[model samples]
Target chain A: MIIAEQKPIQEIKAMIASYQKILVVGCGTCVTVCMAGGEKEVGIIATSLRMALRLDGKKPEITEDCIQRQCEWEFVDALKDRISKVDAILSSACGVGVQALAERFPDKPVYPALNTTFMGMPEKHGLWIETCRGCGSCELGRFGGICPIARCSKGLLNGPCGGSQDGKCEVSKEMDCGWQLIYGRLKTLNQLDQVEEILPPKDWSTDRDKGQRRILREDVYYEQTV
Target chain B: MAEFEPKLIAFCCINCPSSSVTVCESMGMSIPTNVEVVRVPCTGRVDILHLLKAIESGADGVYVAGCSDGNCQFTDGNVKANRRIERVKKLLDEIGVGGQRVEMYRMSAAMGPRFAEVAREMTERVRGLGPSPLRR
Candidate 1:
C-alpha cells in the first residue's frame, strides 16, 4: 500500500493560510491503514489546525471529511458538494489522492497534508517500512520473494555488496541487508543455485526510466458506438 | 489582578488511578477545583487526539493518571499510555504549546493521598507555565 505521514501542523497551516474556509479531506484506504490520513486522523489534524490557526489570531473556518478511496473517480466525485462549500482543500490522503482531487476540481486549490513516503506495509503495530519500489517489474520468483531493488541500499540484482556486514546494511545498522535476506531465504529453500546464475541488467524502459507508465486494457474498455 | 487558575483535565484509569481519586474524595481531601477528572477504562484509551482536544477546548493543562509501572490490569495499558503521552508532549513542543502542560502520573488504588498530591502538582505546574496560549 502507499504509505504516508501527515505533514507537520505548521506546514499544513501554511498551505491553507491564504484561504479562510478550508476542507480537510482524508483517504479511507492506504493512508488510513498506516494511521496517517484516515478518517480518524482527519478529525485529529482538523482539530489541531483549528487550534493552531486560532493561535495565529486568524479565526479561519475549517471542516473535515473522508472519502472511501480518494484515488477513485466516484469516491472523490462525491466530495463535489462539499468542495463547493469550502474555499480550498487540505487533502490528508496520499499524493495520488491529492492529484486525483486536484485533477477533478481544477477550480479549487488543493494542498497535500501528507508526504507520501513509499509502497510498504507495517512491520509491526505503528511501524511501517518500505517493501516495494513499484519498479514495474517482478522477479521475486528468482530472488526468494524479496525485492533487492526496493530493500537493498544499492538495487543489486546479483548478490550482496561489500557493505553488507552480519546481515545488516552499511547504510544503517537497524536495516537488514536485502541481499542477505534473499540469500538466507534461498539457502533455507535449498535453492542457493539460483544465485550462481548472474542476472542480466534490468531493462530500464520497463521501469520508471520511461516517462509516465500506463496500462490501457482494450478488453476492459466499452465497445465503440455504431 | 486575579490569580491565574489553570483549567486542567485528568484522564484517570478506572482500576487504580480512579479508585485513588475516589478514596481521596471519600477522605475529604479536596482536589483542586481547576482540575476536571475524566474516568477511562484504562490509560491506554487516551490517544494523542484526546490530549490535543483537551488543550484545544480550553484546557490550560492536561494529564493522565494510570497504574504504576508493570502494574496495569491489562498488563501493558499504562505503557501504551506513556508512549502516547510522550508523543503528545513532543507534538506540543513542536507546536509551541509547551509540552510541560501535559503529564502522566502512576499510582496504585490505595494511594489516595498521592492522587491529591498529583492534582496539586499538576495545577502548580500549569500555573508556573501560565495559561495555555491556545486556550479557547
Candidate 2:
C-alpha cells in the first residue's frame, strides 16, 4: 500500500492559515490501512486544528469528511457539495488523492496534510518500511523476492558493494544488506549458481526518468456519446 | 477568576476504580464537585481522541484510573492504557497545551483512599496550571 505520515500540525496549520473555512478530507484505502488518514484520523485532525486555531484567536469553520478512495473520480465527486461550502480543502490522503482533488476542482484551493513517503507494507503494529520503488518494472525473480531498488542503500544491481559486513549495510548498522539477504535465500534454495549470471543494466526510461507515467487501456476507457 | 476551580474528567476502569469510587463515597470521602467520573469497561477503551475531546470541551485536566499493572481484569488493559497516556501527553505537548494536564494512575479496588488521593492530586495540579487554553 502507499504509506504516508501526517505532516506536523504546525505545518498543516500554516498551510490553511488564510482560509476561514476548510474541509478536512480523508481517504479510506491506503492511508486508512496505514493509520495515517482514515475516518478516525480525519476527526482527530479536525478537532486538533480547531483547538490550534482557537488558540491563535481565529474562529475558523472546519468540516471533516472521508471518502472510500480519494484517488478515484467517483469517490471524490461525492465531496462536491461539501467542497462547495468550504473555502479550501486540507486533504489527508496520499499524494495521488491530493492531485486528483486538485485536478477535479481546479478553481478551489487544496492542500496536503500528509507526506506520502513510499510504497510499502506495515512491518508491524505502528511500523512501516519501504518495499517497492515502483520503477515500472519487476525483477524480484532475480533477487530472491527482495527488492534491492528499495532496500539497498545504493540500489546496486550487481551488488554486495564491498560495504556489506556481517550481512549489514555499511551505510547504516540497522539496515540489512539486500544482496546478503538474496545470497542467503538463494543458498537455502540451492540456487546460488544464479548469482554468478551477470545481468544487464536496468532500463531507466521505465522509471521516473521519462516524467509522468500513464497507461492507456483501450478496453477500460469509456467514451461519452450523446 | 473566582478561585480558578479546575474541571477534571477521570475515566475509571469498571473492574477496579469503579468499586474504589463506591468505597470512597460510602466512607464519607467526597471527590471534588468539578471532577466528573466516567466508568469504562477497561482503560484500554479510552482512546487519545476521548482525552483530547475532554480538553476541547472545556476540561481543565483529564486522567485515567485503571487497575494496578498486572491486576487488570483483561490482564494488560492498564498496560495498554499507560502507553496511550504517554502518546496523548506527547501530543498535548506538541500542541502547546502542556502535557502535565493529563495523567494515568493505577490502583486496586481495595484502595479507596488512593482513589481520592489521585482525584485531589489531579485537581490541584490542574488548578495550578489554570484553565485549559481551549476552554471557552
Candidate 3:
C-alpha cells in the first residue's frame, strides 16, 4: 500500500494560515491502513490544528471529513457540500488524493498535510518500512520474491555489493541486505541455484516522455459494462 | 487580574491510578479543584486524539496516570500510553501549544499520596504556564 507520514504541524500551519474556514480531508484506503491519513487521524489533525490556530489568536472554522478512497472521484464527491463551504482544504491523504481534490475542486485551495513517502507495508505496529519504489517494473521472480531494485540500497541486480556486511546493508545498519535475504530465502526453498544465473537489466521505460504514467481500460469503462 | 486557575484533565487507569486517587481522597488528601479525573480501563487506552481533545477543549494541562513501569496488569499498556504522551507532547510543542502542558505519571493503587502529589505538581506546572491559548 502507499505509505505516508503527516507533515510537521508548523509547515501545515503555514500552508493554511491565510484561510479562516478550513476542511481537513483524510483518505481511508492506503493511508488508513498505514496510519498516516484516516478517519481517526483526520480527527487528530483537525483538533490539533484547531487548537494551534486558536493559539495564534485566529478564530478559524475547522471541519474534519474522510472518504473511503480519495483517489476515486465518487468518494471524493461525497465531500462536495463540505468543500463548498471551506475557504481551503488541508488534505491528509497521499499526493494522489491531494491532486484529486485539487482537480475536482478547482475553486478551493487544497494543500497537502502529508508527505507521500513510498509504497510499503507495516514492518510492525507503528513501524512502516518502504518496500517498493514503483519503478514501473517487477522482477521479484528472479530474486526469490525480493526485488533488488526496491530492497537493495544500490538497486544492484546481479548480486549483493561489497558493502553488504553480516547480512545488513552498509547504507544503514537497520536495512537488511536485499541479496542476503534473497539468498537465504532461496537456500530455504532449495533453489540457491537461481542466484548463479545473472539477470538482464530491467526495462525502465514507462512512457517517461509523456510526463506521467496512466492506464485506460476500455473494457472496464462503465458504458461498456452497463 | 484574578489569579489564573488552570484547568487540568487526568486520564487515570482504573486498575491503579484511579484507585490511588480514591485512596488519596479517602485519606483526606485534597486534589486541586481545577483538575478533573477521567477513569479508563488502562492508560494504553489513552490515545493521541484523547490528549489533543483535552487541550482543544481548553484543558490547561493533561496527563495520563497509569501503572508504574513493568507493573502494568496488561504488561505494556502503560508503556504504550507513555509513547503516545511523548508523541502528543512533541506535536504540541511543534504547534507552539507548549508540550509542558501534557505529562505522564506512574503510580500504583497503594501510592495514594503520590497521586495527589502528581496532581499538585501538574497543576502547579500548568498554572505557571498560564491558561491554554485555545481556552475559550
Candidate 4:
C-alpha cells in the first residue's frame, strides 16, 4: 500500500493559510491501510485545523470528505460538487491521490497534507515498514522474498556490498543486511546454486522510472462486454 | 462579573451539540469569554490529541457534546468519541488530573436548556475539581 505520514501541523497550516474555506479529503485505500489518510485521520486533521484557525481569530469554514479510493476517477468524481465549494483542498491521500484530485479539479489548488512515504506493509498492527519501491522490475524470485530495492540502504542486486557485517548493514548497525537476509533465505530454500548466476546491472528504465505501466485483461473485458 | 472567570468549554462536531451554534446563545451564554466554540463535522473527528491539548492549554473543563448515541448523524461517530474520551479520561488521570476534568455529552442543537444545563453542570464540576493543575 502507499505509505504516508501527516505533515507537521505548523507546516500544513502555513500551506493553507490564505484559504478560509478548506476541504480535507481523505483516501480510504492505501493511505488508510498505512494509517495516514483514513476517515479517522481526516477528522483529526480537520479538527486540528479548525482549532488552529479559531485561535488565529479567523473563522475557517472547514469541511471533511473521504473517498473510497482517491486514485480512481470514479471515486474522485463523487467529490466534484463538494470540491467546488471549498477555497482549497487538503488531500490526506498519498501523492497519487493528491495529484489525481488536482487533475480532476484543475481550478482548485490541492494540497498534500500527508507525505507519501513508500510502498510498504504493516510490520505489526500499527507499524509499517517499506518493502517495495515500485522500481518497475521485480527480482524477488531471484533473491527470496525480501526486497533489496527497499530494504538495502543501496538498491543492490546480488549484493552484500562488502558493507555487511555481523548480518547487519554497515550503514547502520541496527539494520539487518538485506543481502544477508536474501542469502539466508535462499540457503534455506536449497537454491544456493542460483547465487552462482551474477545479477546483471539493473535497468532502471524498465521499472517505475520507465513511466506508468498498465495491465489489461482482454479475457475479462470480453467476458464482460458479451 | 467575577474577575476570575471559569475556563471556557468547547463543543465540537455534528455529533457534538447537534444543533451547532444556536445552543450557546439560547443557553444565555456568550462564548463564555474563555470558551472557544470549535465546530466539527462529527464527534469521530475529535482527535484524542485535541482533548489533551485543551487540558494542556489550561481549560478548567472541556466538554465534547455530541449527538445522542442512537441519533449520531454519522452513525458510530458518537460511539467512537465516547471511546476516545474514555481513553483521554484515563490519560488525564495518569497525569495526576482527575479524568472527570474532561467530559462528553449527547444533545441536539435545539436543546438550548440542555446546553445551559451542561454548561452549568460542567462549570460546577470543574469548580469542585479546582483549577487545572497546569494553570499558573
Candidate 5:
C-alpha cells in the first residue's frame, strides 16, 4: 500500500491562508490505513485549522469530507457538491489522489496535506517501513523473496558488499544487510549454490529511465463499435 | 474584564477514572464546574479528532485520564493514548495554540483523591492560560 504522513500544520496553514472558505478532503484507502489521511483525520485537520485561524482572528469556513478512494473518479465525484462550496481544497491523500482531484476540478485550487512517502506496509502500530521501490521489475524469486533494490543501501544485485559487517548494513548499524538476509534465507532452504552464479545488470529502461510508465491491458479495454 | 474560567474537558476511561469520579463524589468531593468529564470505553478510543473538536468547540484545555500505564483494562490502551496525546500536543503547538493546553494522566480506580487533584491542577493550569482563543 502507499504510505504517507501528514505535512506539518504550519505548512498546510500557509498554503490555505489566502482562502477563507476551504474544504479538507480525506482518502479512505491507502492513506486511511496509514492513519495519515482518513475520515477521522479530516475532522482533526479541519478542527485544528479552525482553531488556528480563529486564534489569528480569521473567520474561515472550513469543511471536512472523506471519500472511499480519492484516486478513483467515481469516489471523487461524490465530493462535487462540497467542492463547489469551498474556495480551495486541502487534500489529505497521496500525491496521485491530489492530482486526480486537481485534474477533475481545474478551476479550484488544490493543495496536498500529506507527503507521499513510499510503497510499504506498517511494520507495527504507527511504524511504516518501505518495502517496494516500484522499479517496474520483479526479481524477488532470485533473492529469497527480498528485493535488494528496495532494502539494500547500494541496491547491490549479488552477495553482500565489503561494507556489510555482522549482517548489518554500512548505512546504519540498525539496518540489516539485505544481501545477508538473502544469504541466510537461501542457506536455510539449502539453495546456497544459487548465489555462485553472478546475475546480469538490471534493465533500467523498464524503470524511471523511460519516463512515466503505464500498463495497457488489451483484454481489459472495452470499446463501443457503434 | 471578568475573570476567565477556562472550560476544560477530560476524556476518562470508563474502567478507571469513571470509577474514580464516583468515588470522589461519594467522598463529598466535586469537580470544578467548568470541567466536563467524558467517559469512554478506553483511553485508546479517544482519537486526536475528539481532542481537537473539544478545543474547537470551546474547551480551553483537554486531558485524557486512564489507568496507570500497564494497568489499562484493555492492556495497551493508555500507552496508545499517550502517543496520540503527544502527537496532538505537537500539532497544537505548530498551530500557534500552546501544547500545554492538552495533557494525559494515569491513575487506578482506587485513587479518588488523585482524580480530584488532577482536575484541580488542570483547572488551575487552564485558568492561568486564559479562555481558549477559539471561544466565541
Candidate 6:
C-alpha cells in the first residue's frame, strides 16, 4: 500500500486559515490500509482543526467526508455536490489522492494533510517499512524477495560492496545488510548459484523518473460500455 | 421571544436518541428548542470532531447518547464512542474549556423517561457551568 504519515496539527491549522468552510477528505484505499488517511484519521484531523479554530476565536465551518478511493474520477464524483459546499478541501490521501482531488476540484484549493511516505507493507501491527520503489523493472528474482532498490543502502544490484560487517549494513549498525539477507535467503532456497551471474547496469529510463506510465489490457476493456 | 434558549448539539445513536428525545419532551424540556439532533448510524461513527464542531458552532454543550453497552445492535459502537468522548474530554481540558462541556451516556430506546432525566440533568449541569469560553 502507499504509506503516509500525518503532519502535526499546528502546521495543518496554518494552511487552512484563509478558508471558513473546509472539507476534510479522507481516502479509504492505500492510506486507509496503512491506517493514515482512513475514516478514523479523518475524524481526528477534523476534530483537531475545529479545536484549533476555536482557539483562534474564529468560526470555521469544517465538514468531514471519506470516499472509498480518491484517485479515481468515478469515486470522486460521489463528492461533487458535497464538494461544492466547502471553500477548501484538506485531503488525508496520499500524494495521488491529493493531486486527484486537485484535478477534480480545480476551483477549490486542495491541501494535503498526510505526507506520502513509500510503497510498503505492514511490518507488524503499527509498523511499516519501505519495500518497493515501484520501479518499472522487477529484479527480485536475482536477489531473493527483497528489492535492492528500496532495501539496499546504495541500491546495489550486485553483492555487498564490502561494507557489510557481521550481517549488518555499514549505513547503520542496526540495519541488516540487504545483500546478507539476500545471500541467506538464496542459500536457504538453494539458489545461491544464481548470484554468480553479473547483472547489467540498471536502466533508469524504464523507471518512474521518465514520467507517468499506464498499462492497459484489451481483455479488461470493454468494446461497449458494460 | 420565548426567552434566550441555549443552543445544544446532541450526537446520539438511534437507540438512545429515541428514548432521550421522548423523555425531554415529556418533561416539557424538548432539548431547550436550541439543541440540534445529529444521529449517527452508531455511536462508534461519532468522532471527536463532531463534538468539537458542536462547540465551535456556538453549542453550549455537546452530549453523545448511545445504546447501553452490550445493548448496542452494532456491538461496540457505544463503548467506542464513550472512549472517544473521554479522549476528547481530556483534549478539552488541555484547552482550558474543562471537559465538562462534553459528555457520553448510554440508554435503550424504550428508556424515554430516562432520556428526559438525563436531558434535565445535563441542562442544569451546563446551565451551572455557563456558556463555553469560545461562545461569543
In order of appearance, the predictions have TM-scores of 0.97, 0.95, 0.95, 0.65, 0.94, 0.65
- The residue ranges of model 1 lying beyond 4 angstroms of the native Cα positions read A223-226
Q: In candidate 6, residue A83 scores what lDDT?
A: 92
Q: Model 3 — TM-score against the truth?
A: 0.95
Chain A TM-score per candidate? 0.96, 0.95, 0.94, 0.90, 0.94, 0.92
DockQ class, candidate 2: medium
**How many clashing pairs per prediction, in order?**
0, 0, 0, 9, 0, 1
lDDT of 3 by residue, A1-226 (tens): 9999998888898999889899999998999998889999989888878877787888789988989999988899899999999999999999999999999999999999999998888888988887787776677877788878888989898887889899999999999999899999999989998888887776778525547888788787675421
Instruction: Summarize candidate 5's per-residue lDDT along B6-70 as a digit string, tens digits.
Output: 88899999998889999999999988888899999999999988888887777899999999868
Model 6 residue B57 distance off true place after TM-score fit, in angstroms: 10
lDDT by residue (tens digit), candidate 4, B1-136: 5545568557566544746357667666654455566778888888787786677566877888788668777788888988889977865664455589888888876776776677777777777777776663
The local lDDT score (0 to 100) that residue B117 gets in candidate 5 is 95
lDDT (tens digit, per residue) of candidate 6 on A127-146: 89888998888888888897
Cα RMSD over interface residues, candidate 3: 1.0
Model 2: DockQ against the native?
Answer: 0.65
What TM-score would you give candidate 2 relative to the actual structure? 0.95
Q: How do the residues B1-136 of candidate 6 rate in per-residue lDDT, one tens digit apiece?
A: 3533456677888666665676657767545555567878888999776777677667888888899868888889888889889977876776556689789988877677777666667777777787777764
Question: Any idea what lDDT model 1 has?
Answer: 0.91
Clashes of 3: 0
Ranking by DockQ: 3, 5, 2, 1, 6, 4
Model 2 per-residue lDDT tens digits across residues B1-136:
3798999999999988989998998899987788899999999899889998998888999999999878988889899899988978877777778799999999989888889999999999998998898874
Error of 6 at B84 (Å): 10
DockQ, per model, reads 0.64, 0.65, 0.83, 0.05, 0.80, 0.19
Which should have the higher TM-score, number 2 or number 5? 2
How well does chain B match by TM-score in each candidate?
0.96, 0.96, 0.96, 0.84, 0.96, 0.85
